[model samples]
Target: MATSSGAPAARTFFGHPWGLATLFFTEMWERFSFYGLRAILVLFLIAPPADSGLGMAEGTAKALLGVYMAMVYFVALPGGWIADRVLGARRAVLAGGVVIMLGHLSMAIPGGAGFVYLGLLLIIVGTGLLKPNISTMVGKLYQGQPDARRDSAFSIFYMGINIGSLAPFVVGYLGEEINWHLGFGAAAVGMALGLVQYLLGARHLAGVGDRPGDPLTPAERGRVLRIAGTVAAVAAAVLLIFAALGRLTVDGVTVALTVLAIVVPAAYFAFMFRSPEVSAEERVRLRAYVWLFLAAALFWMIFDQAAGPLNIFAQRSVDLNVFGWQMPASWTQNINPILIICFAAVFAWLWVRLGDRVSTPQKFAFALVMCGLSFVVMSVASNAAAGGARVSLLWLIAVYLLQTLGELSLSPVGLSVTTRLAPRAYASQMMGVWFLATAAGDAVGGQVARLQEPWGDVRYFLLLGACTMAGGVVMFLFTRSLRRLMGEERRAVPSAV
Candidate 1:
């Protein structure tokens, strides 16, 4: 509705802009498709061929899962660039949703590994285009709004994510207990519904995410395409040569990607440190961010295994039999989201009530300690299951509860800290860097999970858990220094609440 001055009046959905509602549902469905597929990805890989599965080695399957998870984030940087430069965030989101639906459909076909790989590739590409830009759109919705309102809007948006993420228990059950292809198809339908909702709500999204923030000139666009084509051709040629030499195996590809994910981010940080664009104070903050980044990576490396080694552990070691019924192992992935929904508000209230009493580094220290303890508990469970006895379902539930605490401590705080510490010139890119921490961590975790094949699960849980607690202790030592670097005024601004 137009105001008296021929300008559109601000419309609100539950007190925020109406546009937020559109973006919120879009993101919800996107996450629904993503978490749904992830819930069953490993299960389908290791299931017996006679059970219509791939019959892949457990190590290979896990490594692939890690690489796939890493690639989703790693690819998002370029994806966001493309959305900002060419398609605009809105169109990119629509295109991405369509592509994701297609990806799920591809996997649903009753072919072999080839179609599954094709599906995964499509999902990655679609997600790359869609995931980051939608959040960008959310930010756009509150262009001139105060920080507190923006934060509240995001809280509402975040609830959509957790709500969507709960699809795994529902979709995952069908995939595990009924038919795997059916589950994939259901994910596709979820995306389709998201697209439908997005289209219907497009009228509400006018003046946001509708144009490139920094569009390239036509000549620049051509140059970019040529460069991209050349890079792709050369990379493909190299892969073909390796394929002919029989060295282009899955492990080889995963190793190369892992190296790429870790090394590129490290090199970027080094360049940023030396750049004249960064002031001395900014550089000091960047140094602090470096520590935080490592802490975040360490946190995610353990946390993200919910779909890989942890899932396998639940399948092999947890008694899925409930009272009189047998529960699907994939349903285990739903616990964290359930906990998040139940307690996200309580955690927020605690942070608000505590105010700045807790520093960012201190919160991260808490996360590391709790993450370590979760695995320590898992280590005990692993030992108990050593002789092929299934432990009670409460064991995995306990681990997820601890990790959820760790996640609430770190995830939102990590974002707030990164935004606070980023240099002005590279403010947006630093958000991508925050995701890079996850990619690097997941890539490394993939490689680490491979050790389970040689070292076994009990030792794996015990050793990593011990090391993580040590990491927490080290972070606590540096807490005062990091708080100083973030600036005294920032310290007084209260915690991320």
Candidate 2:
């Protein structure tokens, strides 16, 4: 069992206790590795040969990014399956860390394109295994309605993600600016550290990820085989089709993703609509959750830009001056995590104080608006930069603050909502699908990020901000109906007899 860090044990820091610190630190390092590579990813790819890069075109870089992110999130579907049915969450997470470490190490190696691509493949596969399972473990830590502290727990966990995110900028500063392989090497080391800590903490986990030790019943075993077969068939079909078309690039990939985007969710809805297993009201609620998932995806599409175009914009246009020191543009990536740690507590407190009054739908609505608003700041900064040499760093900070608040409102809630709303039999797969939606959104964001304007940076920001706000407004307009559909705010009032 992993020993606690000498911190006092309480009923709930917000709502959870054991395994949090374990998960927190584990996720922290994991994010550190993930985001560290991400921080310098585009910069490295786009950097001039004078700076030792392949000097790939922006469109190609974005396309590669889309494919990379799509693979990462898409693989999670199978990863979640393995966690639920075979390896269990604990082993899956550890295995994922190892895979990621290998990937990062591969990236660290010099002069081998095959090695670099292979490393990316490894990292993507590893993330698929680790990401959803670790999150599943976090959900496992709570049972029933997890009270106000649940958000705080997620916030703390969220901080770990940011803590991990913060390291990349530092690593990027040192590695990318000085030595490219160094950054990749640092990411590998980070994952290795995560694997070690996760193993050390295994004892504290108890029943969390303990898989069913016995051989599966014939029916369950058959179901597993069926699912695996279905997934394999689907993947094979998609790849064969793609190969035949001779169409593989940013546009081709995006079109495929967009066209298929509605299919999964739509199929899920069709299944729920036809199934007799669930009550009609339950179906309504499930449908609402699906919409929430869609809206959440839209929000992430905009917010995720922080790592892509926003990172570039910050590096190029934003002025970072503090006490006679100019912070690297990539360092702005740290701001979101820093704010997450600070506001997580406050947001948790707000929920505690406002219990039952604030609906999940409302939170979702807030997230959408915040995501949209963050883009506006980006637009404003871009516009301002037209006249001036450098826009104030404060604009970047403002955007992060809004985006973080939006994230605080919705992101953690997503895990809880999915676990609560999804059917018992479909828990892990459902979560995987939810994450797959995220992958879809990320793919979209990558496409949008590449489609810059004639006015350069200003056009993308304005379009993104408007689109984000429009999505939010659409959600808000439907808020009452959505609330009703979700059955989220209902209270058992006494009859007036």
Candidate 3:
């Protein structure tokens, strides 16, 4: 590793290191591919087979979407470890990009449902490798810079994320209005572009993400490689057997993934809490994180459904007319990203301006409340649909705007807090635990979305909205207790988003 003094000091983009720009664009294009797929996935899954879809039931499609999203995050645990102990972040990212491109190409091929399944699996694995390591590299870029600059760099990086997120509109339109394969091909092109730029800008990365954080000894390396190879072979064989038996149904996979999502996080918590390596103070912080984790899960359960029930609602109920042009339903998914790009700076400014007036727990409470209000807005729209009226697209936009505000309050802060509270020996593990919250949420969210078809839209939206509001109220009441558990060290945690 290069020492701070030995590192290049020249400012390149917006007073940050040149590497920030590299990571920024790389992440931007990656997210473009990711969100573009997300915007069209459920639509493609549920559309008629004659229309280039699988013709899966809405409930089944939502369940699969949820499972797929959960697996994408869940795999990051091993993915991060792989980067730390085997492949360096740079190589992992390159390999992951190649896999993602291949995934998109597979989806673009005109074939049966098998192609979709194969594409999703590849994308999930590729995302697992790319997502966490890229964020780690961004942090590495500001390693020796002033502490304040780290937050700014992350803010810039997030803008890149939203910039990439904007692609869903174009890609979704192509997928929904034109041909699904074209949209998938566009996503492949996006990843290709990102990979090309990453290669070109490799020099800017310098000492960042170039080597494993924890290199293994020769003996340890041999043991790990042997174990990993064995595990991979066993997994492949088991999957093949399952597929051959015709037992690999979507529902079966969803149920299995949901169980893993719950069990893995529970096991992680137990291990961390019981470990002698964790000090008493660290244990208290971990307990606080449990509450934070649950809060995040609830928030995501509602937010992530944008691609499931909410996407369906937009297509079925909302009149997407803007200036005499009918828009594709997937275009509605773009609202949240646009809001994030527009207001991320404002939220950052608000946090700084509020200073000591706000606490982490308070911010979380606010997020939950905002999320509940978003659902409440949706409930109203649902009621309008029940009354046989097509609501304005503004209703869905309002819901997305409110949810984006909640995301700004919570998501980045959650990441910062997870890092701050992590034990030195288990930093990456703690980050994985944080991601598990998202996995759990998506898994549960999928199951919840399944109820939408049977329960009717009005009742379903109202029920979810009421439950989320109650959760926010409970979190608000527990805020002081959570703050106490965080102790004085909570003051050091920086707000992000």
C-alpha lDDT of all candidate models, in order: 0.90, 0.77, 0.88
True-vs-predicted CA distance for residue 344, candidate 1, Å: 1.2
Model 3 ranges with Cα > 4 A deviation: 1-11, 229-246, 489-497
lDDT of 1 by residue, 1-497 (tens): 89999998888888887888988998999899999999999999999988889998988898899989998999888989998899999999999999999999999998999999999999989999999999999988878879888898999999999989988877888898888999999999999999999999899886798898999999999999999999999999989997998879888888888999999899989999999999999998899899999999999898988899889888888999888888888889999999999989989998878878878888999999999889899989999998899999899989999999999999998988888899998998888899999999899998888998788787888888889989999999988888888784454764364
- Candidate 2's clash total is 3
Identify the candidate with maximal lDDT: 1
User: What's the distance in Å from true for residue 476, model 1?
Assistant: 0.3
Cα lDDT tens digits, model 2, 1-497, are 23298765553333466578788888989899888887777777777766766577776676566657766777888787777667888888989999999999998887745676788889999998899888878867775645655545676787678778788666787665687778889999988888887888777776788782234678988987898799999988987888788775445756676545546556766786677877777787787887898887788778777777787787778877779987766678888888988887788789767766766777888898888888888878888988657888889889999999999898777876887788655655677767766777777777777677344777778877888888888887887788777775465233334
Instruction: List TM-scores for all candidates, in order.
Output: 0.95, 0.85, 0.93
What tens-digit string does per-residue lDDT give for candidate 3 at 247-271? 6788877887898899999998999
- Residue pairs with colliding backbones in model 3 are none
Once model 2 is optimally superposed onto the true structure by TM-score, how far is the C-alpha of residue 209 displaced, in angstroms? 2.7
lDDT of 2: 0.77
- Worst lDDT window (10 residues) for model 1? 488-497
Residue-level error in angstroms, candidate 2, position 396: 0.6
Our model 3 lands, by Cα RMSD against the true structure, at 4.0
Candidate 1 root-mean-square deviation in Å: 2.8
